[model samples]
Target: MNKVKVLLAEDEASLGMIVKESLESRDFVVFHAENGEKAYEVYQTEKPDILVLDVMMPLKDGFTLAKEIRLENKHIPIIFLTAKSQTSDVLEGFNNGGNDYLKKPFSMEELIVRIKSLLNRIELKPNIENIKIGNYTFNFTKQTLIHSSEIVQLTHREAELLFYLVEKKNEVLDRTFILNKLWGNDDFFNARSMDVFISKLRKKLRNDDTIQIMNVRGFGYKLLC
Candidate 1:
């Protein structure tokens, strides 16, 4: 079996080496980068299964790197390592697309535990297929929504949002719950992003009059069919 791959970016050479060796010992394939710029380059090239990023680094920063990654792949888990333990800093990490945040001096064991938990959660997500939503067929694997012979290709985030809504059709989804599950945070930035995706999905599904995604004021949304 192939080991889980990690892209680790840390400017501190000694600490980076230690982390690389520790994860390697646990049968993880680690790609270590000494700066944020190199980390992004390696990420595009290697396409690691997960990312471990230090907050402060040369070239680019962890938050910036994470934001860029999220734009391309919303599902990839990102763990941010920061020396700052302030609540504001933690919030910043989440707002910038971190799945989890670990303050400096974190235990290696704890990091491994978090990684395993994230992977398990992702793996256990329901792999829905060929779901019928009103007049359209949603193919989750292909990320496509088909109506008769016309097909609309959806971005990964759009497909994920639509999938969750369809799974809970007719139920009012809590905004915070959906935000946390989908964007890894319920921060303002992510909330806006979710709203955008919701609007786009609504427009796409407009052709099907029987299907509706209703907004529950001050709450969340409900997909009615």
Candidate 2:
């Protein structure tokens, strides 16, 4: 079996070395870079399975580097390592196409756990057992969401949101919680983007009379059946 390839970009040499050693001990082939530019260079050459990036870096910021990666492959999982803890900072990471994020001064164990969780989700295989959602039949394992005879191919984000909503059917998803978990932060712009996605999802399921997606004012969204 091939070891999981991880690309680490951190200007802090000592911290980067420690993280690389830890991951390598766990059977991950580690590629290290001291700056964002070198990180991208390594990425282009290695095409690592996941990326660990520092927010502030030399040559180019992590955010800019991540945007470049997103343009090449949107689904590639990215975990931001940042010293900044503001809500806006976290939201910006997600808005640019990050999956899992970690605050700096984090434990190596925690990082490993998060990385494993992200990979599990990225490689998620659903058990399609006739899940009924109003008038639709969802076959998640097949990656096909069906409404009557029409099939909609969902992007990973769309599928993830739908899965979470369906799991909490008839319940309201709290705005802050949803944003933090799904989007990494609850900023004004991300909140707006979430609304847009909600609208798109509602439109996708509009054919079902029994299904409804309601925005709870000042709170979050409720998916009802």
Q: In model 2, what lDDT does residue 79 have? A: 92
**For candidate 2, lDDT tens digit of each residue in 130-179?**
57888887665444568867987654456567777887888888888877
Q: Quote each prediction's TM-score.
A: 0.62, 0.68
Using alpha carbons, what is the TM-score of model 1?
0.62
The lDDT of each candidate is 0.85, 0.80
Local accuracy of candidate 1 as per-residue lDDT tens digits, 1-225: 878999999999999999999999999999999999999999999999999999999899999999899778767888999998665676567657676777789899978987876777678666667899999999876678999999997765577678889878999988998887765568886677678778889999989999989999899999999
Write down the RMSD of all candidates, one decimal each. Answer: 5.8, 5.6
Model 2 TM-score is: 0.68
